[model samples]
Target: MVKKQDQVTHNAKPTAVESRGGKSTIAIKGTFPEKYFAKKATMTITPAIKNYNGEIKQLTPIDFQGEKADGKGQIINYKEGSGFNSVQNIPYDPAFGKSILVLNSTVKKGEKEIKLNEKEIGEVNMSTKRQDIDPKLVYKNQTSDGTNYYFSEHNYIPNNLVVKTATIFFDFNSDKLNWNLPFNQKEENKQALSELFPFLMDYDSIQSIDIEGWASPEGELRRNQQLSNNRSLVGKKWFEKELESYLKKQSKETKSFMKRLTYKLYDKGEDWDGFINALKNANIEDKDKIINVIQSQATKIQKEQQIQNMIAIYDEIDQKILPCLRRSYFKISCVENLRTDEEIMRLVNISPDSLTKNELLYAASLTNDMEMKKKIFSKAIELHPEDYRGYNDLACIKVAEGKTDEAKKLFENANVLKSNNDVVLNNLGIMSYQDKDYGKSEKYFNESQKAGMDQSKNLALVKDTIYTIDYQTKPDIEETANDDKTKKQKSEDD
Candidate 1:
């Protein structure tokens, strides 16, 4: 008996091959590499001998120096020969789209050199008139490969830059926090605080602690003042609670010993401790001096705390910085458990609510996760919509999502409630421009510019729009094509 023959056909889908313009042309998995670089492009880096920290400074450049076998270590190519030499000119390809080709290098005091790879192709050097660009580009600098270089990658920052940093780097304004935390968590104040916990715990000698809060020189004086106070208190309180809790988990003897002689807390509730302490330590080793210091410090700290309490209820002053301002601190009383105290405090400080909304918003903005930010800001808005800051913050999320209409309305509401708010006006202009309403955009942008907004680029953008409008309105190919086909034009010519 003849068996029925089975028929089969291979109708597999094609693998996708990316086009130059960033789209898939065909589909077939094995035909394409798992990943490919974006088209390479050239960029020029200029070097100059500028006075750096009162000394003639030059850029120490290095080539790709790692072993080629490491895949990442290969010297793809250098614009010129590699050596410790003055970089007169170097051409290199800008990082292959997002793929960075980093060359680790180092520099010496009073030494200057320049190096180039296939990525660097040009250089322009000028006087310190270009200081602004340095701040914009050189958020961090580093040294590697025997030369000084601006760190283009986050991981390279600490290794390259050197400055007058305290031994306790992360201790308030110390350079320690400059190091990038795990998973970009450094941008998150809470995460930073969270990370700070273990550090504090490690320090067993810290029997007392003080946290002073500061504010940027913006916003209402009263609000800023109150915010700084709250933040100090909250920060201290969190640290104390966390330390106590952690201590409670220790051996009974340890816990009892720590409790009896470990905890001492003080929150000047504002930025008054330093000033009062200075006055107290003002070279008078007498009781009168101590009394004066106590009186002055007590008065300022008490008044600041009272002001913060009032501000907490002031709906109109609902700045997101309030929580940062409303911070309390843990001041360890005795020298014992100081290490435990610090560790516990750091852990407390790192908790989710340890940071202010502004900090969270700033951190969220750095990540690719709009949903996370939206989830956070959205809830904040719902809880505090009447406050200008909450609405403004929510509007920022809307803007990120390309919801111009909604963002514009929100900005308008924010502006109406807080007329002096520059962020609302600036964002309103941004939304208007994004919506292609150049006229409205220009108006808002001008208002922002006149208000001394920090973003000079916005003013330039408004001018660019005006120029674009002029060029677009001028007769062009489309207008000529319409004229050529129009009967009215032909009749008028005849």
Candidate 2:
């Protein structure tokens, strides 16, 4: 029997994740390109931030960044929050058959509008901050003005598309993140650091952040104090140096920077007030004299009420707040006028899913631009051949542009790899229909239906079209025999 924990289908593909607690719900509905369905996926939640303490009631709102296409999308909204809990769902590609998720927690708000299909959803109202309007939606070969998902040929279908949302906790002290060593002192960590620095640099727009270093009280008080202080200084320098290097690589044209990067360094030497006090009550340490001494110092620091004095008080609580006190981070401020899509896309192709290499190729066919479609399709084929989406998508482009012979060859290749995919069967049927081979067309159409490409209405339309082909091909019989039979029948009736 499968265990309760096993119900999540750890090995099976995941579509999305859900919040563990709290009643807030997430609803996702989006459209895909015409005649296409997304592959099975395992959705992983990456929590970027969390507020377990429940001290903060609301998080800052910010636009969550995601791309339907591998590299051809943008984050064009104004507000995403920096709240305590932010969760993202990352999907993997089907063609590559790899499992991956990039769930991140952000301390931001979730109300941001994206321009899809020239309509907007999840957008904030202008007069009031509350969201009041349903933005437009665009899906494969169709657009929704708000009430309907309409196809290009004016056909309408129910808005059956739904997206799953989940909340995940992002581990900060992890040895590795997203298969990259986040804090390791190796090549993997270097790459992780590289990724981190870009986001950290963005925070430099803030006034400054406080950097307090701490060391366990294992040795002499004075020695531990200085050691902690030195460590903070080292971290500050590393951050500063990395920032400078990143700025140098930005662009030759920019001569100015937004905010000055700075940090305040402090060290709390050998003072385990928080930890030691807890231990004292538990009789783990019989150091009344020591506790008394530390309490006096803590009381004095609390009275100061200055930033420097606060650091001292904060240090006193490090024992009780091991996670917060041992942490090293800087406050970053938001800036206006960030880089454009053309600029970011220039750096790398934004993948639809980290695990899915083939899906990126599937996205290539979605591109209407011929040049881009060819480039993405080639990359997809290079990555994986076991999957038929790549071959079929590329073949689709051929059929769209009237390259029937080339499309037929591509279909043949795809059939060899996967005989059951409806997409390939449907395309093959359409190709045969267009080629004026009525018998071949009927065979392909039947095959498509057998393969579960069962659109009765579409099949009916195809059947009607066959009559047009017959009338064109058998013009002599239509012009002579059909007219004589009709004339005889009418004369008899009269």
TM, every model? 0.28, 0.26
Global lDDT of each model? Answer: 0.38, 0.40
Provide the lowest-lDDT 10-residue window in model 2.
123-132
Q: What's the TM for model 2?
A: 0.26
Candidate number with greatest TM-score: 1
Task: Please report the TM-score between candidate 1 and the true structure.
Answer: 0.28
Tell me the RMSD of model 2 versus the true structure. 33.1
Off by over 4 Å in 2: 1-359, 362-366, 465-494
lDDT of 2 by residue, 1-494 (tens): 01121221111111222222211222222222221211211112221111233211222222332323222222212222111223223221122122111122221123422221111112110110111222221223453332111111111122222211111111222211122322233464345446644564433234444555554443345555665666566556665666667777875222355234455777654335544554365432334654555456654343222223333544533333232223233333344223333432342265433424523543443445766765665555566677665566667666556676886887778877888655566566556555555457567667767877553643553454210000011244346778999999999999
Q: What is the lDDT of residue 492 in candidate 2?
A: 100
Ten residues in a row with the worst lDDT in model 1? 1-10
Top lDDT model: 2
